[model samples]
Target: MTDTTSTETAVRTGLFIGGEPRQTDETLTIVDPAKPGVIVGEAASASKQDVADAIAAADAAFPAWSALSATERATLMAEAIAGIADERDTDAAVLSQENGKIRFEGFIDALVFEIRWNLALMLADEVDTGKTLPVVPGIPVTTEVSYQPLGVVTVIVPFNWPIAILAAALPHALLAGNTAIVKPPPSAPLATTRIVQRVAEKLPPGVLNVVTGRDENMAELIQSPDVAKVCFTGSVNGGKRIMEMAAKTLTRVTLELGGNDAAVFLEDAVIDDVHLDRLFAAIYDSTGQICMNAKRVYVHRSRMDELVAGLEARLNRVVLGYGLDEGTTMGPLHQPAQKAFVEDIIQEAKDAGADVREYGTLPGGDLAGGNFLRPALVVDPDPSLRVVTQEQFGPVIPILPFDTEEEAVAAANDTWSGLCGSVWTADVEAAQRVGSQLVCGYVWVNDHGATRLDLRAPFGGMKQSGIGREQGIEGIRAFQDTRSIATIDPEALAAMAH
Candidate 1:
């Protein structure tokens, strides 16, 4: 993709408040993960006062924005979606520059498509509405339930796939008659802030807000009493802290937390070199930064060697470097710190007696400068090891041997987080049965992360993964209030009043 913005043009990089773009004295430098030394872009660092201003905007605009009919809200959402699409190349370029993802892989191709996929979820469903009310027992009276807006919502998104997740939560909140304050990840705020600025013109003032910063400034925004609800996506520790802060204001929250998802390979599963390669491609894509990335692989002891050998051979062909390079299957870790953390864990796994081997050579002579780590596969990993159990958000996979389907399901569910997992087997009944046994919000059979769910599927978790849903008709209900209105005939009312 090309940079659509003219060379002479200066990008309006700042905080978005009240449907306007304004800069702050404080600025945050966004790094290019591909070349750690290069400064790709900068975003305004919102102060406490800026956050207060955003909440104030949300508060002032909520009444009008919410007063519009669902059709009107949906129209504005559709316009914003179109505007975002118009800025696709620009957004993609900026995303690649700031995120250190390859322009095609990271920006236009991989994530923008996900954003559009999420956009399809924004179109409200008329069928799900107008549900009939249940009749009262021992009486001819009836009670109906309707959805109402929850007021101003604050969306705090994580770094990886910021645009997609924001699209996931924001449209649902707005369509339900609520305004939004979007807090982009501090590390890569430029793309999101700019996208919001470009699209804000399509909505009424205060309908949506974007604030960027590095510290607790946004935390105060999430905890503000003026903010009605908070939707967050990040690590478990970060989520816990946000929940605690939200509790002070009794703020409603939807926490999409971390995941330690796994993939199970049964002995009966059809095995071929081509199939194994395709599976590795899905897992290692995006350097395994995806929340649902296969962090752990449980293989039957009988086929463990075959799977390991196939994975190692396929991984050897992956081209690892900056995302912009052609055929670069593996990009650098999102940050230098992330690279260090992944390396530490890999060494830890090796120290734990697991045999570790690298597939591709590190990129360039200056591998130390960039945040790249060669994709690695650890064989015969102990189930209790940190690499096997924890959410290692990197291009590392740990292989563990399992004896039976029960053991595989048990191993998959033995985690603090339950976001998503996958089960592979030849028997249709076995796949469905074992898939149900794994404790997760979403599961894939014979697949890794592809889902065909519409806006009507509830997207959330049961354990530490998250608190509330964020897709489909169920998601819109999350941003709404259910009130019971009771009525009776005049004579009955008189008798009840008496």
Candidate 2:
């Protein structure tokens, strides 16, 4: 569990290419998000040349890696999973420093990646590569559908849940027989860097690679011809740029982008103190930075007051401090820019004559230098207000009242971003009826974000929220292409005639 890099690493913290660390002339200092004045470590600020090298390495390894049998790949994935387990504590430490989340959250994220990797590897053998066609009306031939991997997959990831999200795509990509060049988020690259270093060493050279850099280098990853497919998790604008660039090469792309997920409470929702904590955690956990966090809350008019009060009481209890502090349940926003963005949204709602309430107190001793903001709750805000209509993506929840189920559904589906929605009601059948009306990818009847996912179910977004899905068979197949193989033999045809 001892990580030397935690102490301002010795030299050579750079790109891990072809199973080796390659130093670069320029480097970026990773800062502790909770206390910006503190330095975590330095990583190579990869340039275009560095990106090209990584892509070349991935391209070189693609053939053999892709040619590996499913069992072989699964064996390697299991090895990589073991390697990751040994460094879980160290990696979680580094992740906590830059991610500005509690150690528990970082550890959970590390374990999340592990679970996902195992899921993909376990599902590897079950992936149906070839399926027989039963009779194609009037076609006197035996036909089979084959699933093949796209070559090199370039994964562009964001700071939030980098390891888990990368696992969502990269492990499955490898399971489908493809190499990967990963661009770890510059702001919080150390933990993932350590992960890839160990994983790459366990696998063949170029099978897995990691690079850290700015936007221009990401552009290189997108436009490179070596990449046959792309998986990106970031802002909507960034996803668009990746799509536009990948289009030049006709590379397949899967993007998990921004989401303004909504939560609804029917008249019979369990709003008692026992379940109120769950309701608040759904909205405020991860400082409300999660892509699918409950950004909008629509409650029945009778229960709106109770929901707001419960959320406010819960927020007031959150202890904001350094991520490493044991008392800290909620941590600061990832960056100053994000703090300002959330502040602006609160201000916009205020300008529109909405009553906004902020709770919690920042630590004056250790975390005063961090990008910390108390939770904000906008009550009865204007429906069109930015805080209500747009995705604030911070610790701000705006509760609006609905007179009827139809009105609640309309208000919930009114937003342009439809990633996820949850309906809270005691009546299972009633919740189902309301959930069915929601225009989102994943609809929860009684629960919100509790980290338990039914892997068989597809999860993603609708509208401008994102494209494509993650988790389940549908997700694994996104990295592959289908080919139809047909054969017509005179002998076989004669037998069929008989």
Candidate 3:
């Protein structure tokens, strides 16, 4: 039980814990990346003890929540989805204010779609009863396999897509009958907490909770022993550290880590002016903040010049600014460290003999107070440069020209991460063949980043991207413990003994 009235400020801000709003004196200032002096709002910073208390509350309520029939749980989850839908515009506005994404084209629609899709995923499979089996010449035996929830799920959402990452873990956890504790990324905490508060009100006490804080203190909340499972979305290094910490209690983890995805453009691919424009959008959308962002492009040496020219022209037109501004195409990186890191990568790539050509420009000088790094394009003199190999999570595109189809495949699969990739070709058969050859969890053919992710399909990485799947039936199964039940009737046992 929470005091909803206490958490609501004049700004309509609140934290949800145990199905109600919670307030605290500890303040976390939300910063807008584009405008340095513009403070979005202040969010309550939850202490380690607050996190622990939430976990304990979840633990206390787990038995009742997890024992609910699947249908019953799904019904509640449906209502939660409707609640989220009702608050869509409000959620999008705050998300844009905090994270600096263009609300209309980028964050708003995607967040709504992600939540809606997750809800559809929740209702994909119904509760199945035990199947009747023949027992010893016409007698019937019963065997059953049904999904069960883990006790309490703790979802740690990253800054890039606060609502989407929360949706990735929240709906599934609740529909599978698990209580949840959501810790939004520090930079954009208020928007996510507000979203959680809205949805949590419709749930039972202890069924949902939201906490906000700085990065160093965030780990303490995640590694707490009271949490039964954790679903984290962030960088690979951060995911590794979380895994190490979670090892103390052997908490079940679903980590959606970073990616160095390859977009292979084959010789047979037809790249007209229109398709090239769309391809550039696919690569640089959200200022290349997505984990599946196309960091590297492999085009046939024959068409390298054409591809570069087309990409350069289209990228030059992106309108960059704060998310609140109308017609803003690109937004600033949400934090100072991110801007610094991207700038470093761009400079390093140039230093390594790559031809650096930037489409967008940062108006403020370095150390400009706000985090802003514009879109950059790099044409590598040496195809095997570090810029082409590493995962630079920014709007920096590296174009590498390859000679043969085998070479293109080799270049794409050479990365240590295998999260997602794309292949563009007019020859459907060749494109399919190349896509199959790429070592990635998702392969988009003839396009990029538009591959449909069905809820029934398992979602995860093959190599260093991460371990285990998070969505689909496998996701629900990930939250369960299986036991093999064996029994023999007295007559069958006696016959076996004789």
lDDT of each structure? 0.76, 0.82, 0.72
Give the CA lDDT, 0 to 100, for residue 192 in model 1: 78
Task: At residue 130, give the lDDT of candidate 2.
Answer: 79
Give per-residue CA lDDT, model 1, range 55-148, as digits (tens).
9999999999888878777776776666456666677667766666666644543354346434534556641255445444344445566667
What is the clash count for each candidate, in the order shown? 4, 0, 0
Top of the candidates by lDDT: 2
Error of 2 at 148 (Å): 0.6
Off by over 4 Å in 2: 1-12, 135-137, 489-498
Evaluation by lDDT, superior candidate among 1 and 2:
2
Candidate 3 stretches greater than 4 Å from native = 1-12, 105-110, 113-118, 121-124, 127-143, 216-220, 363-369, 450-456, 491-495
Q: Cα RMSD for candidate 1? A: 3.0
Candidate 2 TM-score versus the reference: 0.95
Give the per-residue lDDT digits (tens) of candidate 2, residues 250-311. Answer: 88788888888788899999988867777787788778888878888899999988888888
Error of 2 at 323 (Å): 0.4
**Model 3, CA-based lDDT:** 0.72
TM-score of each: 0.92, 0.95, 0.90
What candidate 1 gets wrong by more than 4 Å, as runs, is 1-12, 108-140, 365-368, 450-456, 490-498
